[model samples]
Target: MDYGIMFQEENESMKERFDLSMERIGQIISEETVPQPFRDYFVRTASFIRMMGEYLRFIESGDQKKASIEVLKEWNRKLYEDILPGHKAALGGYEKSYADPAYAAARLGEGYGRLFSYLYKEIRGDIVFVHENRMKDITILNETFIEIYNMFEDEIPEVSTVKEVLYWFVSDYTDHTVSYRVREGLDPSLSFAVDIIKNYDLNDLKYLYYFGEYISDSELKTASFLNSLPEETVRLMANTYTEGYCRGFEVMGRDLKKKGMVQIRYELGFERMVKYAIENFEALGLKIILCRAAVWTVNTNAGRKAGYYSTSPNRQYEYDHRYDEAIYLNKAFKDRKAAVLKVAYEEYKELAAAYAGPAVMETFGKEGFKPVNKPEANRLDLKQEKLAVEMSNESSRILKQYVPGDETSFTIIAFPVPEIGEDFEKIFEETIAINTLDYEKYKGIQQSIIDALDEASHVEIRGKGENRTRLTVALHPIGNRDRETNFENCVADVNIPLGEVFTSPRLTGTQGTLSVSTVYIGEFQFKNLIMTFENGMIKDYGCDNFENPEEGKALVKQMILKNHDTLPMGEFAIGTNTTAYAMAQRFGILDKLPILIVEKMGPHFAVGDTCYSWAEDSPVYNPDGKEIIARDNEVSVLRKEDVSKAYFSCHTDITIPYAELDSIETIRPDGSRVSIIEDGKFVLKGTEELNLPLSGV
Candidate 1:
């Protein structure tokens, strides 16, 4: 399908108006009216924007489709060849760069900033119009487009005096552009982006390339397949998706009505379902923000990115270059980002106020990611890591200062990708079934286990065979049964196809060796993973996948452990979703599953930030209406006094499947043993139904 024709029959007509923005800016830069230094900057900026525009127009025309390998090369080039020049200039504090003090002051002081601002706004407006209101001729989106376009329609702003305009550009755009940095920092929920896939016409492949984002066959193919699914099936998929989002708000006890919107972040191909989710959210009176991930630095986060996006054309390439920040690190770069974000948020305060948060539709089931580590690629050295952490913390604090942490909520759900293996479709169908599992059945069984756990002072979890996991997680005793419960009875909401009773374990005596035969953490592969915990924090870790010892250590350091010297074992729990495990084994896609889904497949361990990071004070309860008292470990408790020591800003799960386990036992206060899984199978009496999937074996 000509995706544009799906919504935009007049994409050609849009050409003239759209090209004019860049053309007019080019005209201004070419004009002799602008001063030499100011003119030089716009000359470079204008050329870059126009090059991007031309490239976008080419992709939009749906001609000269490049092969995946070719696209991947360009993708590599853009991140390396094309964009790095500008990033380096800006980071090095060069006067010629846009972030230069003299240039910013001049650009903002002169009317040039606002004109360029207006020009940039026009391009942004076009992108937004294409996304939000895709109707006849883009008539609705172009209404604002017409108003903004007419600025150049009247007296063209002078090129010579553009400094002052640039300041307002930064000032006006700050609030809207950077609001999520806070949302991410504070709550970090998946609801931050759910509608991207729910409402759009993913079948309209033209929409794929319109955002000026680089795209490859992988992304287009993914979206096309999803669009091919029956509309009803897609709706069921979306309903399962958005329902998890709403349930998050309901479970959190936050007032969803106060919030007016939900940000939908997703990959390509899921637009058919995205549209349905938008309607579902709208039915609840929440508007949807369908923002794509950042292509420009003003909104980029190097590796840890959010917003609607496409698949990484190459994960190895991405892994190699994740720490691109080292190219331009200093107090100056931080200040520039901070100034820009602050300004952007100020501009969008009203919209930010209306945001409920993100509802993410995540996908998994791709082959296990075994990223080849590249040492030459820029990485945050020890000093840079500290600075990066500090910058993140400060920026987060800046965001929360505007958007309160107490106000929003979110949810995340992952599905399988077609690239998982030979039985991709079969696994995908099974995953859907898992996502829509019987809530009441699991809830009842989970409560029975929680009831048992409430009586225990601590849970002793040990592994067998190649698995060396031995951790004693102390449980917070439930003081009152009538008002509170020990573990939250996880169902098919928020975390779908769920079967785990998890909490922030008391860290005082939570120590021992935790190991998994193999696990995928953060899209990077791990094998024969071992971690030793001392008072909950990860004291030591090792993996045997890479050849050299130091290389393996660095791999774990950068990916799994998030560069922290040590991370607290943030979460420890049993896996109640034996059906998920059975399905994985049956389909032979165990290694391909995402942690979001894999964690549900077995007993897992999380290293870094606890599940209750920002909202420990907000009381949570199990299905039996009992308050879950185990929301904090000793590390999180520091938040009540010192904020610096409170968070490690990461939580990655390493799951041990039932097949790898010796046992998962619950220890009663009197030291009695209650086995949940023994010899790689469910042995708990009430949990026998979970073992039904493994019947033949």
Candidate 2:
């Protein structure tokens, strides 16, 4: 289907207004009406607005579909060249790149510099807007730029004037932006991304540019490598991914027949695998929903991408603007956003109800990015921080109202990107083997470990040499041991290449310090990370990422805690994937692995909501015909009374590698202990095979 035509009538309706915004923007490129440093900002920004208008016209003419590869490559670079690093000058050589918030703050006064740079970054969303034929969105942004520029026409207006313009722009447009985003995730008809994936020729790499995401060397080489793989190899990748997803519904007891749609979240350059996975899901009666990752400032989630995207052109640029919402966040705007979300879900209630949760394909092995926290960037104040938390709570509630968590299930798997090193191909193959491990064999082995754990009242974990981790986790009491198991016998379902059995621990007696010498969580690496838990909630935490201890604390708080003052110890699991640990050790890429695989390589603890966060009441059973009963802890139990206090809406797993381990033992109610793993090797009777992978280390 030609989905572009869906926007044709609307484009025509808004043509006159769009043309006027373009005409005014075109004049500002050369106009001397605005002042010195600020004049450069407006003039350069106006030039970018004109470029977007050209892109919109090109797409509207339908010429993009037939463009040659060379032309397509040139356009893709041109669209993002302003933000790409190492450029001599950005936006026409007038000054250093304003797209760099730090540079902009350096040139302009800190306040105005941050605000203008943020505005310019937001205006850049026009790239995606044009690709999707969002004429009204493009027109509104163009007008916003003109309005801000008009302020400077009168010899530097008060900062309040500029702030007011941005404040209302976010306020007034939240309805359109948030509503469209919610619908984009549910309604498959909004198929700007799906159309390109389904219709484009896989052998031609030119299709990468049509998505409008930044295409780096990593993405290009990744696509080339996949194209060279055998068809059977590709099918194996697709089968592992799709079957894990289907198995999520089956294992979790969610009815697959009730869901009509599945949202595919993946990186660019995995189209061959994603396309095959689409066919696999279609065979299972699922329509694919592929939405572009959020571009608008209001929709972007703290520099994290949710939908489909490519490698970031500038990680620092994204990091600096993560809190752009601080420019206009208030209780009124927060309440307005919540109300808009409810209305949007109301309109798409049917589609939302039919939605299965995300099937995520994560890529690892990029050079680690430790961002320089710039003082000039926007930071939320105390009141704003609390308001932000409230907004998250309300939004989560609204989402569950439409897409009930109990009815939806998700699966996640990871692969290595080409950026790892010279051993990229070897690492990729090894990753595949790790993902497709013998599921039946591991199932039986993991069940043995689960049986031992079911007899414990709590688990004792202590760190080996130089890794001072002393943690005691309280497990839920199994009511009727014959029919109950505390831990799920997890293996390659929902979480692929799975090798761990986990549970939500009772928080009353869960206490002690958890520490890791070096660990990567998301894009940031924490050095000498340590956290003190008192009664299952975070009492204190610190890291050595920054010279100043307080700065390191702030990083942990923002990224891991999601701005909550404290979070509960939601899950505890002993990883059984010795093969994966050995692979990382052989490649010496331990820090480059993603959490999806790393969490299965050692004993890891997760803080926030448990594995059964919103679905605690749902029954989950193991392969042994026993019900897994440890779904709720002290925090999650509050869902029956008050939901806002029940969930933190975040789950971050911090793993301690085998080399850093001492021992893990299960404590019985009679003051006896059963040893599970000691000195980084499995000592249990049935789990000795897990030690074979570490033999040659």
**Candidate 2 residues 394-414, lDDT tens each?**
998999999989999999999
Would you give me the overall lDDT of model 1? 0.63
Residue 19 C-alpha lDDT in model 1: 55
Where in model 2 is the C-alpha error above 4 Å?
87-95
Candidate 1 lDDT tens digits, 613-697: 7777888766667788877888888988988788877788888887777776788778897877778777777877877877754
Error of 1 at 422 (Å): 3.5
**lDDT value, residue 633 of candidate 1:** 81
**lDDT (Cα) of model 2:** 0.89
Candidate 1, residue 302: lDDT: 43
